[model samples]
Target: MKALDIRVMWFQRALHLWLLVWLLSALPAAEWLWEHPVSPELGDPGIVSGLLHGFGVWMPSGAAVPVAIALLLFAVIGAFKSRPWWIGALTWLFFCALTDRAWLANNGGTWLMRNALFWSIFLRVDPSKEHGPLSLVPIQVLRLQLLLAYAITGLQKLHGTTWTDGTALGIIASDPTYGPSLLPVTPGLCWAVLLFQLTFPLAVWWGPTRIVWLAAGVVFHLGTAFWLGIVDMAFAFLVFYLLWFPEEGVAWMMRSLRITSTANTT
Candidate 1:
C-alpha cells in the first residue's frame, strides 16, 4: 500500500480504536442493568423492554449473570465473524443503562467502563453491510445515543466561559465532583484538559501529530483517574484506541497479555 493508503487505513482503524476503548465497560454496566430493571411503571418503558425483547435477551436481575462477559466475547467474535450486527449494537444499549446509572446517581455513574465497552462495539460495526432488520434498528439507536452524548457535552463544555476561555481543566479539577486532586495544580491542569477535549477529535488525522497527541491522550486519561478518582477511567481504559497506531503497538499488547496469561497458567 502507498503511504497515503496506509495512513487512511490507520486513521479509519483509529476511529474504531476510539470506540473499542468504550466497549470494555461491560462488567459494571451489567451490574447496574440487573439492579435497575426499567418497566412501564417507570413510564414509557416500552423502549427499554422492547429493545431487549427484540434481541434474544431478557433482563431480570441476577447475581451471577455472565451476560457482560458473554456480550464482550460475542462482540470480539463478531468483529472476527459477522453475526447479527445488531448484537454488537445491543451491547451498547445494555451499557446505556449504566450511563443512566451514572447520571441518576450523579457521578457519571461511578463506572466509566460502560463508555469503553459500548464503544468497543461502536467502532467495530460496519453500517454499510446488512445484519438483518433487528440488527439495523438497534445500531441506529446506539449511534443516536452516541451522537447525543457528544453533542450535549460539547455544548455544555462550551457553555462554560472557563472552558471556552481555554481553562476548563481547572474547572473540572477544582470541582469536587470531578477532579479534586488537581486542585493544587488546577490552572495548568485545566489548560491541558481544555486543550485535550478541544483537540481530541483532530487526533484522528495522520502523521507525527497523531502519535504525539495520542500519547498525550493517554496521559490525559491517566490524569483524570488520578485527579478525579473515577474508577477504572484511566489510560488503561482507553488503550484500545491506540490499536490504530501501528501493528507493532497492538502486537506488543497482545504479546504481553499472552505472556501474562501463560505465566498465570503455571
Candidate 2:
C-alpha cells in the first residue's frame, strides 16, 4: 500500500466536517420545500418544471430534504473515515439543483458552497489512504477559490467611500443589525483589514509569512463573526484556511507526535 499523505488526509477530514456543519445548519430550512416549490416562470420553464415535476420515483421537492439529510449524514461519517466519492459529489450536485429550484433564497455564499462541495469530493475520499497526485488539483482549486473571494472582496472595498474613508467598520459596527457595537472600530483596524485582504493571496504562498497570516486570518474571522453575527460564514472561511496551511508544518507535527509516543513507550 502507498504511504498516504497524512497532511492531505487531515485536510480532507476538515473539509468533511466543514460540509457537515453547513449541511446540518441547513436542516431547518427543509420546510421550505413543502411550503414553496420552484416557480415555473424562472430560468427555463421546462427545466424548472423538470426539476420539480418528475415520475413518482423522483422530484425536487419530494427528494430534496431526504437527500440533503443523507448527504449530511454521509459527511459526518466521511469526516471520520472514507466514503464513496462519486456518491458524495453527486449528492452535493443534486443539492445545488434543489437550491437553484428555490432560487429566491440563493446567494453568492450558496454558489460558493456549491463550488466548494464539488471540489471537495475530488480530494481523498478514504481518510485511511494516502492521497494521490490527482487529489492535489482539487485542493489547489479550493485555495484559489478562497483567495479570489478575499481578493475580490478587498478590491471591491476600494470602490466604496466608507471603506476608504475608514468609516466602514464603524458604520457596520454601529448598526444594531451587525456588530460588536461596544468594541472600538478604529481607522487603523479598517486599514489593516483592507491591506490584509488585498495581499493575503500573495503573502500566504510564501513559507515564513504563511503561518502569521493564517493565524491573523483566524482572528480576523472571529472579529467578523462578532461584528456581523454571521458565525457560519466566518467559520466556513476559517475552515478553508486549512488548505493553505504548510505541508511541512503538518509533517513536523506528525513527527513530533510519533517521537512523543516512542518516548512514552520506553
Candidate 3:
C-alpha cells in the first residue's frame, strides 16, 4: 500500500477507536439521555429524522438505547474490520438517529463526530486494493471541514466584542458549567488563541508550519480538556488532527510501535 493509503487506513481505525471510547463513556447516561425525562425538543430532529419519518419508520422511545448499543457494536467492528464499508454506513445512520433523538444532550463534539462518520462511509478501508483518485476526495472533504470550522469560528469571534477585547477566555474561565472558576486567564492568552484559530487553516497546509500548528493544537485541545472540562470536544478535534499528520509521521509511529512491541515481548 502507498503511504497515503496507509495513513488513511490508520486514521480510520484510530477514529473508530475514539468513537468506541466516546460511546462507552456515554453508556452510563444512555437511560437518561435516550430512555426518558429531560428536554428532547431543544434540538431539531434534522434530515435523518425527516427521512425516517417519510419512510414511516419513526423511532420509538424504547428503540433509542438499542440503536445506541448497535452503534457502539458497529464502531467496535469498524475498528477491527479491514473492509468496513457497509458497517461504516450503518454506524453513521445509527449515530444520526441517536443524535437526532437526543439532540438536547449533544454539543459541537457530537456534530463533529457525526460529520466524521458521514465521511467515513466514503473512505476506502479495503486493504487489498490501492485506493485510487476517489479515495482522496473524502479525505480532502474531512480536511476542508476542519479548516472551515476553525476559519469560520475565528471570523465570527473577530466580530464579537468579547474575543476582540480579549475577555473571551476570561469569561470562559469563570463559567461554572464549562470552565473551572479558579483557572487563571490572561488577555495575551486569549489573543494568542484567536490568532492561532484564524491562522490555522492557512498555516496547516504549509509543510514547515504544519507541524508547528498541529503541535499548538495539541496544547490547545489538551488545555481545553483539562481546564475547560470539555474532554469530548477536545478529543473530537484531536481525532481529526490525525488527518493532518504527514506520511513520515505515520511511518515513524509504526516504527515506534514495533519497537515497543518487541521490547514488551522480550
Candidate 4:
C-alpha cells in the first residue's frame, strides 16, 4: 500500500476507537443528557434536525438509555469493521438527533465530533485496494476543518483582553468549575498558547515544522485534559490531529506496534 493509503487506514481506525471510547464514557450520562428536563424536543434548528423532526425520529426521553446503548453497539461494530460506511452515517445522525434535542448540552467538542462523524460517512477503508482508490476530498476537508478551528479560535482570543493580556490561562486556572489548583499558569504560557493556535495552521503543513507543531498540540491538549478537567474535549480535538499526521509518522507508529513487520511477514 502507498503511504497515503496507510495513513488513511490508520486514521479511520483511530477515529473508530475514539468514537467507541466517547460513547462508552457517555453511557452513564445518557439519562442526564437525554431523559431529564433538557431532553429531546421537536424543533428545526438545522436541515438535519428538521429532517429528523419531519420523520418523527426525535428519540423519546424514555428511550435515552436504550438509544445510547444502541449507538455504543454501532460504534463497536464500526471499530471492528470500518468498511461499513453506514455505521458512520447512522452514528452521525444519532449524534445530531441527541445534540439537537438537547442543544443546551452542546459544546465545542460536541460540534467537532459531529463534523468528524459527518466526514467519516464518506470515508472507506480497503486494505486490499480491490475497491479502487479512495477519494482524498473528505480527508482534505477534515484537515481544513481542523486548521480553520484553530485559526478562528486564536483570532477570537485576540479580541478578548484575557488572551491578549496573557491572563487567560491564569483566569481559567482560578475558575472554580474547570480549574485545577496545581496548574502553574503564567503570562508566558498564556501567550504561548495564543501563538501556537495562530501559527499551527501554517506551520503544520510544512514538513520541517509539522512534527514540532503536532508535538506542541499533543502537549497543549494533554495539558488541557489534566489541568482543565476537559478530558473528553481534549481527546476529541486530539483525534482530529490524526488527519494531519504525516505518512512517515503513521509508518513509525505502525512499526512501533509491530504491525508493519507482522503484515510484511504474513
RMSD of each: 9.5, 5.3, 5.0, 3.8
lDDT of 1: 0.46
Estimate the TM-score of every prediction: 0.51, 0.80, 0.87, 0.86
What stretches of model 4 exceed 4 Å from their correct place?
Answer: 37-42, 45-47, 52-55, 58-62, 127-134, 255-266
Best by lDDT: 3
For residues 1-266, what per-residue lDDT tens digits would candidate 1 score against the true structure? 22222222233343333334444653456444444433212234476545533223355435224544554555465444444536656655654443343344324422333444444453333433434565344334433343343345556777778765656665565676774443465555555655565565555355466677668766766666776765344543353343335444444554665622111100
**Model 4 per-residue lDDT at 256:** 79
Model 4's alpha-carbon lDDT is 0.74
Task: Tell me the deviation in Å of residue 159 in model 1.
Answer: 2.8
Give a tens-digit lDDT track for model 2, residues 212-245: 8888899998987776777666877876776676
Write candidate 4's Cα lDDT for 84-132 as tens digits.
7777777777776666656666678878888888888887655565333
Error of 4 at 238 (Å): 0.9
Task: Rank the models by TM-score, top first.
Answer: 3, 4, 2, 1
lDDT of 3 by residue, 24-102 (tens): 9878988776677354443344665664322124656577777778878887877786545788877877787666656
TM-score of 4: 0.86
